[model samples]
Target: MYYIVGMHIHIVPNRGSRPTILLRESYREGKKVKKRTMANLSHLPMHQVELLRAVFQGADLQPAGLG
Candidate 1:
């Protein structure tokens, strides 16, 4: 079975637009590693993105405006 073991953050560049920040889950399936996107954080501000990054790092605090 595939199991998610951690979260990963990625920044994707775009032309004529701000870079996109993505949240993904890292999964382990036997000896292989796989990743799946969990959220698209491109619309969020930098501060909020930092906050969410903290959450992904196992912080107990919750970020606002994530609806």
Candidate 2:
């Protein structure tokens, strides 16, 4: 049985430094929610990372004049 809910971006905080940005997949088993890291997005630029996050969240960011 292969069942996965969705994927999303996750931020991991560091004690005295910048945090890590990760792309994770979420799944539910019984009554527990578990997440698995799919990729490490810490090396990407902040704007690019934000765009990817928005896409995952189903945001409609089309060009203003290209509608």
Candidate 3:
């Protein structure tokens, strides 16, 4: 069985291609651990990405406003 433990933002650098930032989560499938991408964050601005990283790291931040 696969169970997610936690999630984090990951940055993948390429030799000739543009870098990609992804939101990934750590999971355990049997005894081995693995990671899976939850979202692609490369399209978002750097500031927003930083905020999300902080939130994922357990930072205290205000809730988003409802529309």
Q: Write the per-residue lDDT of candidate 2 for residues 9-63, one digit (tens) a residue.
A: 9999999998899999999978899988999999999899999999999998997
| Residue-by-residue lDDT tens digits, candidate 3, 9-66 | 9999979987899999998877898999999989999899999999999998877894
Alpha-carbon TM-score of each model against the true structure: 0.68, 0.81, 0.78
Give the higher-lDDT candidate: 2 or 3.
Answer: 2
| True-vs-predicted CA distance for residue 28, candidate 1, Å | 1.0
lDDT per prediction?
0.83, 0.92, 0.90
Q: Is candidate 1 or candidate 3 better by TM-score?
A: 3
lDDT tens digits, residue span 2-38, model 1: 4558986788899999898999888877789888899
Segments in model 1 whose C-alpha atoms lie over 4 Å from true places: 1-4, 59-67
- lDDT leaderboard ranking: 2, 3, 1
Give the Cα error of residue 23 in candidate 1, in Å.
Answer: 1.1
As a whole number from 0 to 100, the lDDT of residue 43 in candidate 2 is 93
Top candidate on lDDT is 2
